[model samples]
Target: MTVTDQLSKVIDKTSRLIDLCAALQEENDLLKLENDSLKLSLESREIKKTELEEKLRVMTLARSLEGIQPTELGLSEKTLDIKQKITEFVREIDKCIVLLKK
Candidate 1:
């Protein structure tokens, strides 16, 4: 090929490569933004889950305490059972948070 023709071809190739690189960089930026959004969404979900778990724990304790016979039986048994149930629920909630973190 003539020197001029070879140089023209090289310029064309170089131009195409530059365009491709620019396009790839744009795509990479978009992907990074999408990933960041997903991470935020996941963190929000984890916080909501934790809140719900805590509410459930509170509801459970409230329900258990509501039906107890405070007149005849001493407060010791009811308090003990509530403490145990609270401990168990807290442990379970901890496990759930650990799993979510993973």
Candidate 2:
């Protein structure tokens, strides 16, 4: 081949290489932007997960209070007795009022 033809081929190849390099660089920049976006999404999801776990823990603690028994306060028997007496007094008053009306 002639020297001029060989140099022309080399120049053509160099131009193709430059184009490829620019394309690759642009793709790299796009990928970097996507990677940053994914990282932010992961961080926000982690924060939401932590918040949900904390809320669940608080709800669990609150639910635990529902099982407390009056016997634990040492007044179960006394309270029951008082409730019985109140019921009997109410029944007696109701009967007396009925008799008085008649």
Candidate 3:
């Protein structure tokens, strides 16, 4: 082949190589942006997970309080006993009121 033709072929190959390089660089930049977005998404999900765990902890603690027997609870026995007696009295009074209604 003529040297001019060979040089022309080389120039064509170089141009193709340059286009391929630019395409690869653009794809790399897009992949970097996607990677960054994924990282932010993971961070946001982690934060939400932590917040849910905290809420679950609080709910568990409230449930634990529900299991506490009034007698064994922090208040004095006298105070709790008085409150219980008052509740019983109210129930009896309610029953009497219902009977009167009937």
Candidate 4:
């Protein structure tokens, strides 16, 4: 083959390589964006899961308290006070969770 023909072929190949590189770079950028979005979604879900767990704990405690008899525990006079304190604690936890969401 002539040198001119070889040089032309090299030029054509170089052009194709550059085009391929650009396409790959675009695809890489898109993949990076998708990865970042997925990470953020996963983090949001994890935070929600933690909040749900806290609520479940509060519910469980409330149920346990319900099943107990204040008279049997010999604290009938303090039963109302204890219930009021528990209610306040639940309210505080809810406020904390709301702050966390922000």
Candidate 5:
């Protein structure tokens, strides 16, 4: 083949390679964004799961305490708000526990 023909072929191949590289870079950036979004979504789900588990634990403790007399619970006769009772129960079971306010 003539040198001119070989040079033309190389130029065409180079242009295609550049275009391909640009397309691949754009796709890679999109994939990275999607991956980051998924990571955030997973983190949100985990936080929700933890919150639900805590609520469940508090509810379970409340149920067990229901059948027991107040004296058994060691709570004073002072008016016990339902919310306060749940908070107390959670604190009794787990020190340093933070209960989400309903």
Candidate 6:
């Protein structure tokens, strides 16, 4: 082949490669954006899950307290029991907070 023709072919190939590279770079950028969005969504869901779990724990504790009958245990005894239970729940919540911080 003539040197001029070979040079022309090389130029054409180089142009095509540059175009392909640009396209690939655009696709990579889009994928990176999608990955970041997904990570944010996952983090939001996990936070919601933790909140729901904490609520569930509180509800469970409330339900257990519901079984207490003030008539059966005198008023003062019932009050003391409730205070103790609340103190225990607070401790548990504090522990959970510490763990979450870690």
Ten contiguous residues with the weakest lDDT in model 5: 93-102
Q: How well is each residue in 3-88 modelled by candidate 5, as lDDT tens digits?
A: 99999999999999999999999999999999999999999999999987986686657557787755677755443446657777
- How well does each candidate superpose onto the true structure, as a TM-score? 0.62, 0.64, 0.64, 0.67, 0.67, 0.64
Off by over 4 Å in 5: 68-102
Stretches off by above 4 angstroms in model 4 are 68-86, 89-102
Candidate 2: tens digits of C-alpha lDDT, residues 1-102 = 999999999999999999999999999999999999999999999999998797656444544564665566565545645755686699999999999999
Estimate, for each residue in 1-102, the C-alpha lDDT of model 6 and write its tens digit: 999999999999999999999999999999999999999999999999998798667655754786865555565645655775798899999999999999
Q: Compared with the true structure, what per-residue lDDT tens digits does model 4 show for residues 2-100?
A: 999999999999999999999999999999999999999999999999987986676557657679755566655456557657888999999999999
Q: Local distance difference test, per candidate?
A: 0.83, 0.80, 0.81, 0.83, 0.79, 0.83
Q: In candidate 3, which residue ranges exceed 4 Å CA deviation?
A: 68-102
Better of 1 and 3 by TM-score: 3
Per-model RMSD to reference: 11.0, 17.0, 13.1, 9.9, 9.4, 9.3
Model 2 alpha-carbon drift over 4 Å, by segment: 68-102
Clashing residue pairs found in predicted model 2: none
Query: lDDT of model 2 at residue 25?
Result: 100
Q: Which ten residues in a row are the worst by lDDT in model 3?
A: 55-64
Q: Record all residue pairs in model 5 with backbone atoms less than 3 Å apart, i.e. clashing.
A: none
Model 4 clash tally, residue pairs: 0
